[model samples]
Target chain A: MSEIVVTHVPHKRSIPFGQEAVGALSIIALGAIGYFLYPDDLAFLTRLIGIAFLVLSLDLVTGYCGVATLGHAAQFGVGAYAAGIACVRGITDPVALLAVGVFAGTIMGLISGALITRFRGLPQLVLSIAVGQLVAALANKLSWLTGGSDGLSGITPGKVFGIFNFDMYSRTAFLFSLGVLVIVFVLLQRFVRSPFGLMCRGIKDDDLRARMIGVSIYPRLVVMYGVAGAVAGIGGALTAISTGVVGLDSVSFERSAEVLVMLVLGGAGHLWGALAGTVIFMIFEHIVAAANPFHWMTLVGLLLILIVVFAPRGLIEPVLSLASRFKRKGEAA
Target chain B: MTNLLEARGVSCSFGGLHVTRDVNFKLTAGDRVALIGPNGAGKTTLVNLITGDIAPSEGQFFMGGDEITGLSIPDRVRRGLVRTFQTTRLFANLTVADNVALAIMQRKRITRRFFSSSTELPEVRAEWSEILSHLGLAKLAYRKVVELAYGQQRLIELAIGLALHPKVLLLDEPAAGVPHDEAPKILEAINRLPSDIAVLMIEHDMDLVFKFARRVLVLAAGRLIFEGSPDEVTADHEVRRAYLGSYADARRAT
Candidate 1:
């Protein structure tokens, strides 16, 4: 009995390590291959990857952490404007732009989180909406700094590492965005599996129970909000860098709603789901717009409604179910 | 012996109606006491006050001789004072083990290190399994709380509370909705908790109350009318008249 107990103590050591290793290696390989083969398309791909990262951040807080916010676009816009202004001022360092974006986003997230923490349900949702509107108003009102309705467009791309200049070819830009995305994905995966992540989930389940168990929900939530904001800010900064422009649309309600739709369509609980959703939504937009730009919004709206009504868990869950069924069939054979 | 928990001059009112009126109570380490009263006697309200869910109009509370009257619920819990809800508050979506593990993790000072993995921590996993096994919930560890029966859900709630390793466990009518057959198991488990961990339970069932509590406190219309042994409480005519009117015949039969 003692021998069995001692051996059984380390049972968690069998946590699918081999599968995770393969997955990580494959992601790195795919990123490298994509970076080399499609250098010219990197700029667009970079923006896509950045948007995916932002969506993942939102999903982490809203989906897994159980915080619902409608004001996240404010953070995204702040970062974009900060990076754009920095670029306009001749500060073209990628690292500096990232820092400025992250800092601005963190501050915005903290303020919004603090305001929303005291509320729940509709009240929280309304507060978030108000925050988004407030940021949009600021962006529109601050014409001199943000370039107002004209938008901040005068941007010069500097070298990423003093050797690789951000040419219109977009090779370096794509690699840079992909690199950041990979890092964010890895970090978020670790966070969600950590003790803090578990506590967030616990708070989501029952705030009162979490309190009785000794978890302080408020401060932890504030920190989570800040982290998520920083991620979104980085995505916004990437957009500014790749496209070399920052506009009032960055803080628009439409942008916030679009991200929310992507998160829901992909599934909120999984990190990869956010990426899948963003990619699919972007692809659909591209295809639809190319075919006929006039009715794209209608088609997308219908698609979202159908997805919410028929497959509320999102497309990823159905795919997972299908894969599991195949595995069962294989075993039976 | 010094009381593990003490509340003095505790009064609370809602708008115009007084819910608790200058109530006084104390529980020493190893003590097992019951708060017995009819519905609307402010029994649950009193629990809420002690647990810091609601602030008192005027009162002072002490745990281990340290004043904790103005602390938050989570703060009180950190100071080794904790309470279970009248209604079981289990995480319906999560597995039983995850619920227990969450409770255990709650007490720790968790840092925001985004690169660290949780499942890799041997200590967390081991503690999780240990608590699950202790509650005889090892088999149902993987089952979601919603999938469990009411009795089982109650057990899981208790398991969650137990995982906190609270010095003082306040149970608000733990067996209120629990089936009679399953009540004994819960009562037994409560009885077996470490003697140093004082228990203050509010229960309506006379038989279960008498069987478990060494002493009983009677409340009538938010005031402490009587405090004595279970036998003494049963024998008190005034106490019986004030709160046990419907149970008079039942009391005599017992």
Candidate 2:
């Protein structure tokens, strides 16, 4: 007599409404409850959330599109300044401010993309860093428009849709920023899953092969860069609206590096990874600063190094793998 | 029948060294021709010129009645001409299926939508499955390219070229790195391809050349020394002298 045994091979499941739809609904519900309950802390959370969106945009270009860039902060800064300047000049209309920010970001993205696309390898990286420095310097030197080192202050947060005033109370600002983040996140998700996204990945893997297959790399790069920049700029505009102030830090190299760190910390290729990285990094920073003022940076630096050396896939991937493993184990049992 | 591809007075030089000098050749549709030459006879360079990898410094190239002298590689591919690299150029990280699927999808006019997964259309999947099955790679469809053997990688490269639906396929040393036993399968696949798709191959394996190629073009020192049937080429005094320097010894063994 012989006993028969069965072996199961795990197969990937098709997209189910239960997973993503429930996840999205839960996020919105949580945000809505947080908006209404913690009105006092809403403004700060709004700014952090906006920064998260900006980091996601960076990941789209650098991680998915495979165009390593250090000048993405320049586009963000331009959008911030556009909205800030508009506010200072009494342009309180949200639509008008968003328009200016998106337009300016798109133009700057196109110009910078064209300049950088001509180069590859280290030259491209250097060019992107130079672009960031140039934009930051322009913001500083043009004291008339940018308000110089003192930074643009006295940005009056106007009412949203003529209903709730964006004030220190923070209810309106939090909802507004959350709304923007959700829209941008959904748009980016769609973009990455499209045929264009596949082409971008192909270009990243082998530009020569892509070109041989009739996929023009330059035009696609330009378009991706412009769109990513525009999204980042919108993120910056959200920052301006929530904080009611725009500073030179918007375009600072350190800020750019911080965003990159957030991207790496979460996982570059996945959108949610960037968001998780940003939130965790921010929360950790707050906790460390409160616990030890002088050693916060050192602790953060050490943490980043450890993560890079050991878990290069970022914190989220390990969690995801573990979750999947548990699910398979449960099914086996 | 008119030649599907014609190279008239096509000469190319690299910084004062003429690699291909006034070399003329014609490839009619349904032709299986072998390009044999010494180490630096510019056979690969001639393949590059024919495939539009580079422009001819002097002279012209025509494919299917159209002058394609300055067309880009992709444009040339779109016009039903494709070539494999001397070195296998597979996307190392992608699965064998994805590599072929990419070629098939790119040939279509599908608009790129972002953030969505690659929806393998029925026709595209059918084409990919057909090509993979034909190349005996259906079992290895999901395997990463780097995990495959050298000969398997070469077959995958050939499968990619076939997926392009080319009117003419140029194989640059297809049997270069394959083992002795694997050479026959590669040659047999090339022989079994549809008659309408002409094959122009650069090869060093004499047995493969003699067994598979209907016609042979010999290049010595970047000049066309002989062009005719395999028997005619073997019989040419200069061809035997230029290529098979030890023909006398080989004849004794036979």
Candidate 3:
């Protein structure tokens, strides 16, 4: 018999330049900048991190898998509610709460994914919107369980690793959220580069061709939705942990639409774009809303219009292209 | 040898119109069969039925003695039944290497691995490299499919088919839309496929068909009218009337 040998080829990079590296570096750099820039307002930064998870999760389903969804906030809400309810019932180890959120979000994702993946294009979008509306309505109707419109309160999360207490100053919460974001960012980077990720990309491009190539499209899409759910769920869990509340707003149609806008503002397919979009849109909105008070919506609308018309791919497209071009020049020199 | 693929009285109808009617054929290992007919002859419909793109209304398909009529498109593919589209369907935005690599990974059942990069896998790399090099596509591996010439894209489809390690390969007008000069390259690649795999080619070009097929199956208006050797195909009265028409008449006059 011929000697069977398996050797791995090292991923060699003469220059440490690629989207994965850029995305990771950007996340860390932004996290550091946020900590420094908003030292007193870590709560705002923490909230942004929570929303960032929702955007990233949306990207996985909508961007990577070519799953069209407007009601992605449903998964996020389910995660938030799950974590909040868990905390009230006394399962408040912050990490364990996150796991609960992830689990709840995944189940919600699978259910929504099963229903939504049954249709294509307009129907898929419509079904997703319907699912979102249905979930929000359910949350509203179940006043006893969800605290109705008043929101669920009295959520007291335990310490981080039984050490760092969740303080009133919000420093610990910010750092915890940032840490989880970075870890998630790294894993998602690997996920989108994986064979499964590539398969999703192929499915996104041409589902017919994907099927012809022997891919069972439905199951893969559902699993991807589940993954997206997990991501979004953790974000929801973080929101509950930091804010100590889960309200109707957590599972609202408005919230769902807002996350979609953030994703669009960033660019949907790129992970960094999702994160960057959330940061920019939230920060911009926060500042503008503070400055204008009443007319802030107009400015946000104008910014969106301008971005859509000029940089249709999202605001991050130009930056990524520029980075690639700069790398090419560096190589030439 | 037991037939690799056998279709028995397979018929498909959409609404009231029958697209494929009572089609039957058998493909054993190492068979080179050309399927030829007019534009609406249901040649592709027959292929679709075999590949499970559309289920047969009144027939059964067997692969190595097992019925596969109820199988999904991907299920048929997993069973080594592969087809290239009439209009070259590739992941246009992806690099040619990636397009081929997707198939290689699928064949190896490693498409679900999320931790490692797909391209960096040694076995996947080995298989795709072999396939791309085999098709003279190694130079264009990094180039996006959208940037390649139409002929080159068709070759990539063949590369994808080969990567799947197919037992039965279907070519749905493999040379369609390819420039006349570049069409033969596709035929050459098809010719170079592994001898163990059976191939069924649908071609409008008679010259290419004559060169590629050892046995030929002719379809006309949803029925298989003729099945014979390449030489005998030209002499058949029915095939001449239905498919060859003026060419056969002109030969008769000469």
* lDDT of every predicted structure (CA atoms): 0.81, 0.80, 0.89
Candidate 1 per-residue lDDT over residues A1-333, each given as its tens digit: 111121122243245445345445655786776577766556667778778867987887887778888877988898888888988988898878888888888888888788876688899889989999999998989998998888889876687867777767777777788777767777677777677786777788888888887777889888888888888889889889888888888889888888988998998877767877998898788778779789998898888889989889987888877986897588559
Interface RMSD score of each model:
3.4, 6.5, 5.1
Scored by lDDT, the top model is 3
TM-score of chain B of each: 0.94, 0.94, 0.96
Candidate 3 chain B lowest-lDDT run of ten: B245-254
TM-score, first chain, each model: 0.89, 0.89, 0.93
Q: How displaced is residue A179 in candidate 3, in Å?
A: 0.4
* Tens digits of per-residue lDDT for model 3, B199-231: 999999888998999999999999999999987
Q: Name the DockQ score for candidate 1.
A: 0.46
What CA RMSD would candidate 1 show?
A: 3.4
Model 2 misplaced stretches (Cα beyond 4 Å): A1-13, A16-41, A89-96, A161-164, A167-169, A316-333, B179-185, B240-254
DockQ of 2: 0.33
Question: Per-residue lDDT of A1-333 in model 3, one digit per residue for the tens?
Answer: 223233322233544337567666777787788789879889999999999999999999988888888899999999999999999999989999999999999999999999999889999999999999999999989988889899999999999999999999798999999989988988898899899999999998888889988999999999999999999999999999999999988888788889889988999889978987998899999999999999999999999999999999998899978997897698569
Compute the interface RMSD for candidate 1. 3.4
Q: Residue B224 CA error for candidate 1 (Å)?
A: 1.7
User: Which wins on TM-score, candidate 1 or candidate 2?
Assistant: 1
